[model samples]
Target: MALDTAKKSQIIAKFARKSGDTGSTEVQIALLTARISELTEHLKINKKDFSSRLGLLKLVGQRKRLLRYLKATKYDTYAKVVSELGLRDK
Candidate 1:
């Protein structure tokens, strides 16, 4: 299930680097993480949902790439984001 607008705004606000920063990388990663988690829960109950599983994998890949980029350019912020989201260290 995709995050609603309200939830999306909340995440954006929480991870935003500055006011009205919806398109920043941190916000993007946070949003993807939220979606990834939601899809994970959905898959847990619907084992036969191959389509959702594929989508979930894609989201994970996207989040991974974004995290890699973040770590490359801003290690401090990357570490903060990863820890805040409870993601595994690389």
Candidate 2:
């Protein structure tokens, strides 16, 4: 599934402007969350798709790294992103 281009661009723009800007954390998390959700739905439809599964794992790893970075650099931003994206308890 394709991402919402406008929204994805907005996140990339924000991150580009300021790497440490916490304002974009929610957007980043939201985009990743959406991707994860989409991949999950696809997996349900094609249970034998190993390539997609690998991609999903890679995305999850990337998201986890971003989350860890946010947590280490700015705990508040990490918490806010986590809450907004409902990514906890996973």
Candidate 3:
């Protein structure tokens, strides 16, 4: 149920600042969001997957921290990422 390299690369490419910018906050948040969504879907079908639930919570916390950092350091980029990802309410 983990994300494959191809999917990870796709997220990085879409959210990265440049071609090789994989460690940026935007990219990391995007990757976490993807994993969070995947795990959420997994949980829908497998309610007893406690390990995956923990993982999903961790990813969500990581994403929240990253978004907090981005919002503090670069509001424009943070707004752009949030708008692009459709995560406005959160």
Off by over 4 Å in 2: 6-26
Q: Positional deviation of 48 in candidate 2, in angstroms?
A: 0.6
lDDT of each: 0.94, 0.75, 0.90
| Model 3 poorest 10 in a row by lDDT | 81-90
Q: Which candidate's TM-score is highest?
A: 1
Write model 3 residue lDDT over 10-79, tens digit each, in one string: 9899988888999999998888888888999989999999998998888888999899999999999999
Per-residue alpha-carbon lDDT of candidate 2 for residues 1-90, written as tens digits (9 for 90 to 100)? 667878667656544436555356555666777788899999999999999999899889888887888798998877866875667834
Worst 10 residues of 2 by lDDT: 14-23
Better of 2 and 3 by TM-score: 3
Off by over 4 Å in 1: none
| lDDT over C-alpha atoms for residue 15 of model 3 | 89
Task: Give the TM-score (vs. native) of candidate 1.
Answer: 0.96
Relative to the unseen true structure, what is the C-alpha lDDT of residue 44 in candidate 2, on a scale of 0 to 100? Answer: 99
Q: Pick the candidate with the highest lDDT.
A: 1
